[model samples]
Structure formats: C-alpha cells, structure tokens
Target: MPRSIDRHELWFGSKLNPRRNSLNLIRLVLALAVLVHHCWPLMGLGGGPEFAGEWLGGWAVAGFFSISGYLITGSRLNNRLGDYLVHRVARIMPAFLTCLLFMVVVIAPLGYLAAKGTLSGYLSTTTTPLNYLFSNMFLKMQYADISGGPYGVPYPGAWNGSLWSLYYEFVCYLIIAALGLFALIRKSPWPITIAFVASVLVQANIEKVSVFLGQNYDFVLLMRLLPFFLGGSVLFLWRHRVGLHWIPGILAILSSLIIMSAFPGWGGPACGALVAYALLWISSWLPSPEFVHRNDISYGVYIYAFPVQQLLAVYGLHHFGLAAYMTLSAGITIGLALASWFFVEQPIMKRVRKGKSDSGAPRNESKSSLPEETNGIEKQGSITATTQVN
Candidate 1:
C-alpha cells in the first residue's frame, strides 16, 4: 500500500531526498520537449504547442532554470569556490566543445559535401568551421553555421539554435556565485527574494524598460529568465518552510493559469515562484526508473539535438513526414547523448571528484549528504544545470 499523505510531514526540504527523486527524469523530459518544439519549425510545420502565449520549449526552459536555481544554490552553499567552478566547468564545457567539434568535423562537412559535391574550400568560406568553433566556444553562439553550409533547411544557416540560452544560464551561474560571496545569501532568503521580485517587475515593465535599455536583446532575455532562476533560488532558501502537499500544488497550478489569463504581461514572470513550487511538488511523488536516477543524459540530449535535427533537415529527411523525422532525430540524438555521457561528461566529472578526494580536503556536510548517485555530472544536487533553445 502507498504511504498515507500527511500535511505536516510534507515539507519540501524533507521530501527532497537526494537519494530518490524524479528530477533527472523531469529534466530529460524537458529536454525532449524542447526537441519536439523545434521539430515543428525544423520540419517547416509552423510553431509547436503553446500555452499562455509561450511556446512549449519556453516553458521547458523556464523549468530548467527553476530547477537549476534550486540545485545550483545548494551546490554553491555546500562547495568551496574553486571546487564549485570546477564542477560547473566540467559539467557543461567538455560535451559542448565536443559537440562543436562534431559539427565542424562531421555534420557541417556532410552538409558541405551535399551542397557542393565535394569538401573543397569548406574550411575557408564565410562562417568557416574554425570561425564557428572559436566564436561559439565561449557559449555566446555568435556563429551558428560552418562554412556557410546547412543551407536549404527550414532554419537555414543555423546549425544549432539551441545554444544561445547557455550563455544566459552561465551568466546566472555567475550571478549566484557572486551572491554566494556575500554572507547575506547564506544566512537568509532576503537577497534572493528581493532579486526575484525586482526581476518580475522588470519583466512586467519590459516594454517601457526596453526604451531606456535601447531594446538590447541580452538585457531582455536576462530579465525574462532571471525571475525563474531567482524563483528557484528563493525556494531553495526557504525549502524548510515550504510544504509540498498535493492541495497546494494544484492551487499553484491553477493560480498560475489564472494570473496568466488575467494579466498576460507580467503574469508569467510573477508566477515563477508558483511554477517552481509546483514543479518541486510534482517531483516529490513522481516515480522514475532507476536508470534515469543513475545516469543523467539530459544535458547531452539538449546540446546535441539541435545540430542533429538540422543535419537531418539538410539531408531532406523532413520530406519523410514529421513522425519519421522525429523518430530518426530522437533515436540519433539519444545515441549521441549516451555516447557523450559515457565518453565525455561522466569520465571528466569522475576525475574531478577523484582529484578532490585525493587532495584530502574536508567535504562539506551539506554536499556530502547528497546521495552517491548524484555525485556524477549534472546529477540531482550538482550545480551544473541544463540549457535550452532561444
């Protein structure tokens, strides 16, 4: 028989056991949701599903930020500055760089060969392979194509439109790191609470604020995403007091929908807290397979799916129809994701942990308290979070 629900026993912090949770599964589903959202456009089928004036991928990305905010804040609080940086870098960069290289060496070449019947002059053209790699190596994604190929796709000249958000996610990491430098965030939730409120207000008044900010794209995006991130941060800081009961979770969902319906402009931003709360609540009782708990390939799926979809489009695979196209894309992307986890992400994280262990440095109890399963790259309690589409 299932355990009985007890209102007093449903505090979020207590239910958030690192040993067992559906967060990895939730993240994987979010990453796949992004892939599905892009499938419509990549297949020239118009936008995918939308709710409350936002695309499905937008919601998925918001979920990613919320989860990241909670996990990363915990990570920072429990880790030394240097160890935190190492884990963050190790989790995100290696696979990302490998994906870029794969684009240059494999995907882009195939596109160039298909277009020109040869690989001649492929490296020297505008948006050359080297240019694409170097320009986006830092995560900003200035260049999305290689040698100006990947032509004839629905999203032409963009090998990977999914990478733009990574820069913002990294920026959020830096923001938390900077905040961690202060004793205020460590002792109380006031700092994150104030930041979340300010971000929501800015999002509500983005149009007027854009006038003074000269319509800067980065500023607008940061404002759009920062609230959810801070929402998660605030939740982490207050987890002990926040209950995860089903009644309140349903209320949060309804409240968010009502607010979005009544006030579209700021409703989404204002409901970040509610959204984060609901997500955690759902995760509390969600059942996930043991494989997902042990192996997190969501990050790999995210960074590789875009380019793979573009490559399939370049080959005119969308002509096979959406079902077949999506099937192939998902299969190939999952295979690549598995490879990335085993070859690049997992091994590197293991080495980093090993090095820390070898150094004989004392482990912070908060982090050490996390389940052994979560010690790997992008695991449940790790600060290195996932990314998404633009």
Candidate 2:
C-alpha cells in the first residue's frame, strides 16, 4: 500500500521557496508557446494549435495571468501602496515603450522601404510613427500599423497583436492594488474568492451580461481573464490549506480537460481554479536552469515575439516554410528578449531596488519578503517584502 502523506508536507505554502522554484522557466516556455501559436496565423497557415476550442496563445496568456495574479497579490499585501504601484509600472512599462519606439524607427522603416520602394513619404504618412508611439504609449494599442507599411504580410498592418493583453494585465494589477487597500484581502480570501466566482458567472452568462452592459470588448475580455487571475490570487491567499501534491495536480488537469471537452465555449472560465492549482503544483517541482532563475526574459519574449514574427512576414520570409520561418523568428525574438531583459527590464528593476535600499528601507521590507506573520494575516510595521515576480 502507498504511504499516506502528511498534511503539513503536502501544503503548497510550505513547499513554495521563491529562490528554488521553476516559475521563471515555466513562464519562458509559455511565452515561447505564444510565439509558436502566432507563427501559424502570421504565416497564413490558419489558426494555431488549439485545445478545448482555444488557441495555444490564448492558453499561454491565461497561464501568464494566473501566475501574475498570484505573485502580484503577494506583492500588494507586502508593500506600501506607492511602492506596489511603482514596482508594477517599472516591471511593465520601460521595455514596452522601448519596443514601441523600436518598431517605429527600425521595423517601420524597413517595412516601408519594402512596401513603398522609398522612405520619402514614410514620416509624413497619415498613420505616422509618432502617432503609433503616442497612441500605444499607455499599453492601449490605438494604431497597429505604421506608414501603412507591412502591406504584404499575412496578418497585415498590426504591428503587435500580443500587446492587447498587457492593458488587461495592468488593469488586473490595479485591481489588486485597489483590493489591497482593505485589510480584509490580507486577512481573508473571501473577497477574492467571491470575485473569482462572480467573474466565472459573468463569463458563463457573458452574452446576457453584454446585452445588459452593451457589448464591450473590455468587459468581455476582463470577464474571460479575471477568474484565472483571481484563481491565482485565491490560491496564494489560501496557500497554507492547499496541497501541492502530484495526485491532486493530475486530477485538476484531468478535470479541466474534461470540462473543456464538454463545454467548449465557457470551459476555460469554469476551470480557472483547476488551471491555477495545476500550474502552481507544476512550478513547485519542475526543474529550472540557473540562467532562467537568474534572468527572467519571459516578458521580453512575449512582448517582442509577435512583432518579430510580423516583421518576418512583412519581408515575405514566411514563404521559406514553417520550420525555417519559426527557426529564424525564434532566434531573433530570443536575442531581442535577452537584450530587453538584461539591458532594459533588469537594469530598470535594479534601479528601483537600489532606490528602495538608498531610501533606508529595511532589508526584510523588500519587494518579495513575507512578514513574520503567516496565514494571510498582516502584522503592524511589516509593510514590505522581497523579490516581487511579475
């Protein structure tokens, strides 16, 4: 007979060691999955790999949100409001803005030259590079094309389709920040639990809700995405009670698959908790390389991959066959991702950390450090933590 597992041994909270976890590796894989998924459509090969009626990119993005929800919630509970907001912005914005500028100055010119055979009118076009940059500076993509170039691409005009999700991700960050204002979120999981359940219900009945609320994409996307994020938040809040055992993890994955098989449309929302739990469980034991543990390039991969693929398509590189195209795109994207991480993301984050240290903040009060208190309770003056994950 199999030995019975001890309750304390199975607890996810006890097993969660930030320094040793494979979350960064998992996130990078998911980012690469998104790149692969987009490869199909950008190459005019039809929709990418699908499971449970959703594309691989969609599932990968869901995974991103789930992980973010867990880590970001922990961040909020462990920091002052100002510090939380600063970290969130710093984590997301710098490289994002740089990507937009790079697209305009470098990618757009190359695309315009390929399409128009000249760069004379590129700067003076209706959808100018300046317009693209300014419009999407806030993470909301208003203009997807620059100088009306990228004409020959399979998925023409759109510079970066992957960026749409960033707006929603930031919104989720703000939501956590708002919720953290109340001590209840730090004390009990009920607030996020109820929110998660409510989001699921809204998604299940989204058509009717859209009828009542007047057909908004923002609302629909939030309803679709929030539950997964909240599911992660719920897991973090109740980590002590939740087990990270393989048996339970396998069960959750199977349950999600069954639900998806049965209900194609709303199955994802219904399986949010299962997905979150399975992801966390997998992260708990998955082995990660030292490089990934030290440098997280997942965000860079995600933010840069779509545009890289689009540029390839713009140059008619998709005609080179899927394998060749994917190989080239992955190479370029990974290179850019590394630059973004080491040059942009990591440096900026380091400055943020340095600023905090220079301000005389206590060492234990860093971004990811948990307080001495445990089990969802916050003690007085224990207002910071160490090493926040995005």
Candidate 3:
C-alpha cells in the first residue's frame, strides 16, 4: 500500500491521534463547488437551483465557514492573537487585493471600453472600479457596477458578488479572537461556551429582534452562517473530549438532514454541527493528494472564479450554456488562481508568518510546532493545525 494510505489506516485502526488529518483537498473541492454553483446565475438562469430553499452555493459557503471555524479557532488558541490576526490577513488579503486590483485596472476597464468604444468614455466612468476597490478591500459589503457592457452579464453591474461573505467571516474571526483571549485570561472554557450559546440564541431570535429594533435583516443568511462558525470553534475548544468515531459522525449527519427536512426553522444548528463534524471527519480520515498538501490554491480559486465567470458572461458566453461556461471559466480561473498563489498569496503569507513568528518568539504560546493531540497520532506532517486556513 502507499505510505499515505498506510498512515490513514494506522490512524483509523488505532482510533488515536486524529490531529494530523489534513483538509486541503476538501477545501479545494468546496471552492470548485462554489465556482460551479455560480455558473447558473452568471449564465442568467435565475438564482440557480435550490433544495429545501437552499442552493448549492449556500451549502458550500457554510462548509467553508464550518471549516474556517474549526481551523481558525485552532489557529487562535495555538498562537498569539497578534500572530493569529497577521496570519489571517496574510492568507486573505493578498489574493483579495490582487483580485480587486485586476478588476479595477483590467477587467472593468476592458468591459467598459468594449461597450463605449472610446478611451475617454472608459476613463470618465471610473467611479465603479474605484468603489469596487475601496469597498471590497474594507469589506463594506458595497459592490461596484461594471458599467457599459455590450450585452452585459445577467448579474450586470456587480463585479464580484461572492466577496460579501468575507466580511461576515472576518466578524466571526474577531469573535473567536475575543473569546480565545477571554478564555486564556480566565483559564476556563465557560466564557467561550457562553458566548457561543448567546450567538446561537441571538441568531435564532434575530428576526424578532430585528423587528423590535425597526431594521430589516437577512435572518436566513445570518442564521445559516454564524452557527456553523460557532460550532467549529466549540468543537476545537472541546476537541480533547470529542470522539472521532465514524458511527457517531454518520449518525449526526443523517439526523441533521432528517431534522432539516422536518423542521426548517430549528434545523440550522443541528445542520451546523453535522456539517462541521462531517468535514472534520473527512479531513481526518481521508488521505489527501500530496500536491494538495503542498500547494493550497483554494483561496485563490475562490477569490478569482466569480469575476472570471462574470467576464465570460460580459463577453457574450452566457448563451454558451452551463457546461461550456463552467468548463471555460473554471479553466481560466484555475490558471489565474495558480498565478495568484505562486506569485502573490504564498509569497506574502510566507513573509508575514515568518516575521510574526520571529518577532513573537519570546511570547509564543504554541506548544511545540504542532497542536498537541490527545489521540496520539504523530502528525509531523506537511499540514499542521495552525497551517489549515480558510
């Protein structure tokens, strides 16, 4: 048997040392799934197919958050808050900024020039690209309109609609950081648990609360995203006691699906737990490709795919149907993602992480190089807990 499969079997047979599980391939899969999901809407086909009022894109985003919750929490608990924040920024900002710049300088301008057929006209209409840069960079939830597309995309005007989720994910990161700090200060897990429960309760009652406050709110979006994030944090906080058995993991997934089918309103929290555990189990049990372990281009793929899809639509490929659009967009997007990772994201990340680690050497709180796992799996592997990012 291959060494990777052997390692997997050993981890499984021993039922110990589950900390070495890597989710690189899983993350890439989720990112590609998001790309696929966006193809429908970008092709001007309504808002895409939905099951139980939830689309594949929604599920994929939830999966990303659940994984982020677990991995980010693990990151914070194992590193100083400053180091944690630096790593987070390094992982997200480089690719994001690159995308924004590309959109502002290249894609939007070309689209406008294509429509207007004049340099002066394109230059005159610069507000949209500038707004896209500033707002998205700040995570302000404001999107830029790529004006003057000849035929335009179905979701015309909006440059990159997929980016809105980054804002919420950052908010979750802050919450985890605060809770991690409090837990460290108090030397207890109660504070984290209490905060998690409070967030869940607030999310559950968000609609009523929004009414009382006289404000419109996206209750479904709020409820769907936050719980999974919190669930991942909780799982990491209690990892020592949590069992990684397959039977229970399978049961939890089945039960969550059944509950979601029966009771829509209250089913979210259960689904959050189910998704988090399922993701964790898969990452832990499966043997990922060596290339996945070495090169994490999922973030690049995610941050680039939407804009590429939109560009394809702007060029009049929206009529090429879903299969053609998806295949071509994914092909171009993956190529761009590779460049983003190798040239921008990975280099910036390596520098920032190295600098932070060196500067915080005296105060480094992480034990050894890897997270201490109770399950006894020797995880001197390429992917460490701290290295698993969104």
Q: Which candidate is the best by TM-score?
A: 2
Spell out the clash pairs found in candidate 2.
366-385, 366-386, 367-385, 367-386, 368-385, 368-386, 368-387, 369-385, 369-386
Residue-wise lDDT of candidate 1 within 95-208, one digit each (tens)? 899999998999899988888889999989999898888889999889877898788888888888888898998899889988999998889989899999999999999989
Each prediction's whole-model lDDT (CA): 0.78, 0.78, 0.67
Model 3 spans with C-alpha error above 4 angstroms = 1-22, 147-151, 184-186, 216-223, 360-390
The CA lDDT at 121 in model 3 is 57
Candidate 3's TM-score reads: 0.85
Model 1 scores worst on lDDT over the 10 consecutive residues at: 381-390
TM-score of 2: 0.91
Report the candidate with higher TM-score, 1 versus 3: 1
- Model 1: how far residue 329 lies from native, Å: 0.8
Error of 3 at 317 (Å): 1.6
Models sorted by TM-score, best on top: 2, 1, 3
Task: Give lDDT tens digits, candidate 2, residues 140-208.
Answer: 888888888678888888878899999999999899999999988888889899998898888888999
**Model 2 lDDT on a 0 to 1 scale:** 0.78
